[model samples]
Target: MSPRKILGWLRAYAAHDDPLVATANLVALVVASNVPFYPVYHLLLIGRDAWPALLEAPVALIFFAIPWVSRRSGLVGRTLPPLVGVANTLFCMKILGEASGNALFLVPCVVAAAFSFRAKERWVMLPLVWLPVAVFLLSIDRMGAPLAPFTDAQFAAMLRLNAVSTGIFVGFLGMLYGRAGIESARASR
Candidate 1:
């Protein structure tokens, strides 16, 4: 194919409006977010301890592949949303387990799920917001001072606050998006 045709095809692929695309984009954002830290980690020679950050790349690739697989497997509408949600939730838990302060990353994951999945699929996003809190609560003793750079109480409070705030923020955005979508549908009709 010509370069122009390839570009046009790529644009159409990206604009396909599939939930898998949204999920993949969110995962891509997560991968991008890690880019800046890599240089610092390497400069500080802490890259060896930063192995978890390396996992995001492959995860992002898998997320990017999901849309194509779903397109062929007929899983886009039925299975993909929940699968993405669960994967995101697990990813959040892994990050939280590795570093407590990184809990903030869960918010965007939840928000992405909100934007990707329909209202009826909102349940998928809920655990993405809450699982980190549960992990934090369960691992409180091991998360203080040397390991976490915060007191146990402070870390707990921060984790709880982040989870609650993210939930509310994503919920509000979801409602706003839902209303806008409804209005757009009505206008179209």
Candidate 2:
């Protein structure tokens, strides 16, 4: 399908779906986009212990499922993405170690959650936000030895890659939410 057609389809899809579904789709796309890069990430490690990176494929599929599942449950749609993100990042960080920088993704999880819900849903939003922070806090002192034997230079590269990627995701989120805020204000006028 053409890029225009695909985007038009997404625009139409966003129009009909509950607002939560849009966030779910965004989360899905982010995860799915990284799937192809997993091999490259493994290559950076000189091809050692590629299995942890392999786990992201199923996680992406799981993320993609959120929008479909949201048709039936808003709670699931809003809750699953960050929860799964926290779980996946924690799992990857544990095996890849802190130096691999998988832990940085938890920030995006918090940002995604913050944008996914409204103030009216503060009770629900509270847990979604806290889960990532909680996971980070609990794991801070517990991260184990690197399972892949990535050299110090490899670790530094991984940290830089993840940090830059996280910044980009957050910037993307700002653009999305910022435009959304403008649209909402215009609608209310």
Point to the candidate with the largest lDDT: 2
Count residue pairs with overlapping backbones in model 1: 0
- Candidate 1 lands at a TM-score of 0.47
- For all predicted structures, in order, the TM-scores are 0.47, 0.83
lDDT of 2: 0.73
Give the per-residue lDDT of model 1 (tens digit) for 1-189.
Answer: 999997676445433344344334333433434434433442243324434444544544544555455455432422443354445445534543433344454455445544544555657555544554565456545543332133455445435644664566466556645654565457558
Residue pairs with backbone overlap in model 1:
none
List model 2 lDDT by residue over 1-189, tens digit each. 999998787555434244445655665666766756765776665465545566556666777666666667776777787888888889779777887888999998998788777678899888899889999889986988866677787777778778888899888877776655565557558
Report lDDT (Cα) of residue 39, candidate 1: 31
Residue pairs in collision within model 2: none
